[model samples]
Target: MKIVTGRMASALRLACMASTVVLLAGCTRYGQHGYARYRTNCGICHHGGEGMKGEIPPISGRVDRIAATTEGKQYLMHVLLNGLNGPLDIDGVHYNFSMPPFRTHLSDEEIASILSYLATRGDTQPVPVFSAADVAAERAHPMTTSMVAEERRRLDALHPLP
Candidate 1:
């Protein structure tokens, strides 16, 4: 085999760098939008998905466990679109707060991206990625925050997630 030297080696290295840059950009495309949105819209309150001492529910490393199922995914959409209120239990901690709905400001795609990012966050095992269509399906049927909470109760009662 002939060895690559001088100009040939330089050209090869440049090509490799270009390819690596493209690959990395593509790799992060799925989560980048969600990350930015999450930071702006969610991180402050949720504290980078860690929550604030059981006062808020976290997204990273938690909750996405349920996103593994279809009904659970639907419940998540409802919660985002309609908000969640009253007392809730997560990982043995109790949180009582009002999570405002983002239906007006966040689009279906944005909501999907946020959830997909959370579900596939580095700290948690990746669940199914959400599609804009999925968010749209839930957006079609609007519900009150209390209604969403009731739905959450029904879902958790039927099938709990750890």
Candidate 2:
């Protein structure tokens, strides 16, 4: 009876271990789906150390400054959907690159995943959840020079830069 009891206990332990392994694998698969999508699409330019002549920005840890601000986050979503041109300032350096709009190509969820992946890359922290509603709002009320100024003004009211 004792030998049979020991064998059953061992078998139960093995089954538990197997179950844990399968559960972990499923979680990894779920996370990797988004990662894979980013690698296939955005990684082409962002990961290529030296970006296209004047097309893509290095989207690795280089986006830290922009990701740290409310205005910047909104601007990023705007740029992702609407694209950008003219004198652009990111991380204090100016890039006169013009990004063709990807609004039609990428859904809001995909764009959010791409941004989340970019933010979590390297030592950077993950960005806040970017909802489809937020993207729609930005699209409905596009950012103009005045809007940028207004956002800055709001930030100033809170922090009051010296």
Best by lDDT: 1
- For candidate 2, write residues 74-97 as lDDT tens digits: 866776776655544444555565
What TM value does model 1 have?
Answer: 0.78
How far is 52's C-alpha from truth in model 2 (Å)? Answer: 5.2
| Runs in model 2 lying further than 4 Å from the true structure | 1-33, 48-55, 88-94, 122-127, 142-162
Quote the lDDT for 19 in model 2.
Answer: 94
Work out the TM-score per prediction. 0.78, 0.56
lDDT of 1: 0.81
Candidate 1, residues 25-108, lDDT tens digits: the string is 533344788877888888889987888766887667554677877888899889889998998888888889889999998999
List the pairs of residues colliding in candidate 2. none
